[model samples]
Target chain A: MITLDHCHKYFHKGSVNEVYALNDICLQIREGDFITVIGSNGAGKSTLLNCIAGSFFPDSGTITINNHDVTKWPEYKRARFIARVFQDPLLGTCPSATIEQNLALAIKRGKRRGLGKGVKNSERDIFREKLGHLHLGLEERLLDRVGLLSGGQRQALTMLMATMIKPEVLLLDEHIAALDPKTANQILGLTSDIVGEQHLTTMMITHNMKHAIAFGNRLIMLHQGRIILDVDGTEKSKLTVDDLLQRFYTVQGEELSMDSMLLT
Target chain B: MTLYAALGAVEQGLVYGIMVIGVYLTFRILDFPDLTVDGSLPLGAAISAVAITGGINPYLSLVLAMGGGFCAGVATAVLNTKFKILHLLASILTMIALYSINIRIMGGPNIALLGTPTVFDAVSVLGVPPYLAGVVVFALFAILVAVIIIWFLSTELGQAILATGDNPQMITSLGVNTHTIIILGVGLSNALVALSGALVAQNQGAADVGMGIGTIIAGLASVIIGETVFGTASIARAFFAALLGSILYRLAIALALGVEFGHFSFNPSDLNLITALLVVSALIMPNIKKRLMQR
Candidate 1:
């Protein structure tokens, strides 16, 4: 379980550039819940994910994960239970590392890494099996550097890495936004497969309205650092891109702009 | 260059190979512009020289010198990671501070080891000529260090260090404490550098504070030249390239020192000029080759 209470985060506090990145936020993430988060630019979607990932501490709040108060925890400390996939493909994996080496690192996530061989002989078959599922011919190229792969392949690999250790919380921040439409759909399929197989508790931030509506069991929309619309189960299953836009228009009235809403 | 001069250059190259490997770890692998090596090199020389002068075993003094260099590296790492200082500025600060610390350790600007027993003397009982013995010992040390470093980099701990340099955020997200990795990586690099410095002091039969000035530049030049000439296809290859690069660099310097143009022979004072030219050529050679290939 992940919980955020009275979360208030301000950037450049007291300065002319001061803006509330997160405002009096209150949220509860149930176990095994796959939540899709949607928001416009500066809508606090990334900030919420960053806070939960322990990238930075919330200015004022209580963030608890699995009943442990992790508000004061550093990113590496929280990484034991949390995994993140960034929007930029380059941000997700080390380009200089080999494919097998990258997988080895992910396998050791939330565990102690010592002086052992990084890509153990025993893990080779497992890595090969996992990469085979991607159908990108990466299974045969385990020794190839991650930099040699295309951006879409990197994102797919990143998704696999995020769930390698069955993380307690998997945060995907616009992970597929950088890929082509076909690649994006393929990665989305892989994401669904991994999340299902592992039963992962996930929070995915996406700009595409269709993906936000299609993927997760629950949906939340953020507007100016506050959750404006939240729906789940039957209500979320019935939601359409137009309905979501209309909801936003009702909330912000004249401030709602189509440019901020990305359509597929 | 004479045959004897060429042999001497190879020996010096082997000793400095260790230092170039150290530079490669920080400048290339860790992506850190560390000037700490400038001071740590002399600090190692001072520590080894003082210990040897005090009747300690020369080999034991090398270990002590390495320890001193490790501590100096940790100081720089702390200044950058903990204090949130820019890495370049932090290393520069450590380098400047080490200048005073090195002098205090040596009790003077220089220490001559004339008539003092050294590691070379200890190894001379093999009945080999002095020049050949120096070459054999330094070569073995260089190869051993290269092998060990290559093996370590293939390990989990070493991969974490590479990842920390490649992308700190990604490594940190994978639950690796990047600050700790940075500290250990930089520390390990400086330790090797110091070991090289200790050997240098023994080879020269003296240690001087100014011996480390521009040491980082020399190391960088060797590394760049190695990558440009030999290529860095793999970690092991890169290691060998660094060693080979150092030897080639020394040979180039030795040959350049003897060059004459229109009755103006190159002076020993032109060492820096030679190094600068070598580095520039190395940097531009690949692009030149590519252009030539297009034609």
Candidate 2:
């Protein structure tokens, strides 16, 4: 579970160009709760995820994870409890390293680094078995350079990597936004399956309202750096993208016609 | 034409190969085109030679050499990462800075501890013959450093640094603190390069500030040659290729020197030209193979 209380984040604070990215946000997420966040460009959805992932420190707030006060923990120290996937496929892995090497790194994230053999023989079989979940034939290519992979393959591999160790919380920042539509669906399906299998508490920021409505037990809408709409369980399932868009307009007092989110 | 001469080539190549590995870390692994290698090489030699001359322990001298190079690498990284200076430009600034630092470390334009205890002194103490000592030192350092590199980059923090080079956003997203990783990578890289310089100074009996000139080119030549020769597959192979490329490059240089044995009484000054030609040949070899394969 994660909680953000009275969170405030400002970019370029005290400067003429300063903009508030997040304002007075309060949210509590329960264990195994899959929350999909929908927002337009600059809706501050990504900003909220960043704060939880410890990429940004909230200007004013307390963040608690699993009953621990983690508002002040630096990123590396906090990595043991969190896992994330980026939108850019290339951003997820070292392109020049072997698959096993990459997996070894993901397997060891947030641990003390030292000199020694990187991958043990036992870990190799473990990696192969895990690679089976992706269905990408990557198991046999454990020694191949990750650079040779297609974007979809890499994203799938990254998603698997992010959830490999099952951190306390999983943050997805428009992870499938860069993939082609077909690959996007496949990855989305994989995400649902993996989250269900592990019962991971997940927060996925999405521009696609359909995906926001279609996946997860809960949906939240953000506008102007504030969460304005929250729906869950039966109510979430009953709502369509049209209904969600209509609600955004009704609650925010503005037309929900952001082309970027709608087009997505 | 004989085994002795070939072994000599291997020794010389192996010594410079350490620089190649350092280059590999920055240029290949970290995905930064750092030209600071040119200056760090001599900076290592200068620090080691000066310390050895000042009666420092040989082991400590190597550490100081590594430290010197670490400083240079840090300067480059700080400039690049913090100041928003471009990578190439940042390296240039560090390289320039190191020139003066090396001079300051030496307390002169150059210094030689030709008869001092160096990285090679341990080998001689072990009763190895002087001529063979170079190769022994090279092999020992190569294995030790290679082991350290392979292990260091595999750890969770190390792996995150690797990920930093691959994708900074992921590292940031993962809370890896990319600025710290950048500094660490540079520090680790140039430390190896400086160690190479210390060994070189000990082998040759002195260090000159000018010794670092063209060092980056030589390291790149070795790396490209290694990639062409071994076809990079893993971290282990990338390292082995660096060593192999160094030996092969040395042999080519030796060949060039040998070719003019009698036709011209070539002096040591010819080394620069010979090195340049060998680099050109190595650069062309892979393209030639690719072209032939197409045919």
Candidate 3:
């Protein structure tokens, strides 16, 4: 579980170009809660996730993961409870390293690393078994450099790496946005399977409304550093995109103007 | 070249090979363009020479020299990671500061080890010919260093260092303090470089304040040449490549200095020029071969 209370993050404070990225934010994520987050550019969806991820501390307020206060924890220090997959495929995996080596890194996530052999002979079978689950034939290329893999394959591998060691929280930030539609669908399907199998507490940011609505148990819409909509369970399942747009109009008192969000 | 000259070149190669491997660890593995070696190498020499002249055991002096280099490297890493100095600038700062430190350590600009006992003395007692003593000892140490490096790179900590260089963000998300990894990596790299410097000072029987001048350039040349010639398809192969590259680089320098063309000869002053040319050719050779193959 994760909790954020009255958090605020401002960029370029006191400067003419100042902007509030996260403002007066409070959130609580329950164990095994898969929450899908939706927002347009500059809506603070990423800022909210980043605050929880400890990329930077909030200007005000506290964050707790499973009851331990982590407001001031650095990103690496908090990584014990969190795993993240970036939008750019290259950002998630070490390209020059072999597939097994990358997986080996994941296996020791949030754990002390010593001078022992990184990839044991016995671990090869485990890695192969896990890679086989991706259905990408990566197991056969265990020794191959990750850079040689396509963007889709790499993203899929990243997702597997993130969940293999079982983090308390998993953050997916537009992870499949850059892939082809066919690959995007494949990754999305994989995401669903993995989340369901592990019952992972996940927060996935997506530009696609259909995905945001279709995947998670809960959905929250962010608008200008505020949570404008939160829907879950039956209400979320019964609601349509039109309902979401009308709700946005009613809540913000204006028509939704983000064309990319509308188009997606 | 004559056999003695060739042997001398090989001896120099083995001694400097340790420095080349250190360069590979930082520039290639850690992705830190550390200029600290320029100072740390001489720092090691200064410490070893001073300690040796003060009646300390030669082998223990090498350890002291490595420890000195480690501190210098840690200083550079801290300046970069903690103080937020640019990595290149931080290393340069350490290097410049070491110029003063090395002199203070030796209490002079140079220390002569002409009659003092050295590590090679122990090897000489093993019945090796006097001329071959340096070569045998240096070869044994070089191979030992290469083996240790190869083993270290396969370890869990080594993998973390590789990941830190490859993708700091990814490694951080995996729960690694990249700052700590960098500090350890850079420290180890400079330690080996200092070890090389100490051995070189003993082999040639003198430690000069300026001995570390052009150290980084030569180490980099050896690394690039090793990668180019040996192909870094694997970590073990890369280490061996670096060692052999150092040897090849020294041999090339010796050959250049020995040859004459139409009454023209390369002066010893042309060492840096020769190193630059060697690195350039090694770097471009791969691309040229690729193009030729395409044709």
TM-score of each: 0.97, 0.83, 0.97
Give per-residue CA lDDT, model 3, range B1-295, as digits (tens): 9999999999999999999999999999999999999999999999999999999999999999999999999999999999999999999999999999999999999999989999999888989999999999999999999999889888999999999999999999999999999999999999999999999999889999999999999999999888888889988999999999999999999999999999899999999999999989998999999999998
Clashing pairs in 1: none
Error of 3 at A33 (Å): 1.1
Task: Choose 1 or 2, whichever is better by TM-score.
Answer: 1
lDDT of 1 by residue, A122-192 (tens): 99999999999999999999999999999999999998888888888999999988889999899999999
Q: Could you give candidate 2's per-residue lDDT for residues A1-264 as a string of tens digits?
A: 789999999999999989899989999998989999988788899999888877779999999998889999877668888999889888888787778878877776666555545676888999999899888899999988899999999999888888878888888999999999999999999999999999999999998988898889999898878998888999989998789777776855544455546777
Q: Candidate 3 DockQ category? A: high
Off by over 4 Å in 1: A254-264
True contacts kept of each: 0.77, 0.44, 0.91
Ranking by lDDT: 3, 1, 2
Q: What root-mean-square deviation over C-alphas does model 2 reach?
A: 4.7
Q: State the lDDT of candidate 1 residue by residue for B127-210, as single tens digits.
A: 878878889889988999999999999888998888899989999999988899899989989999899989999889888898
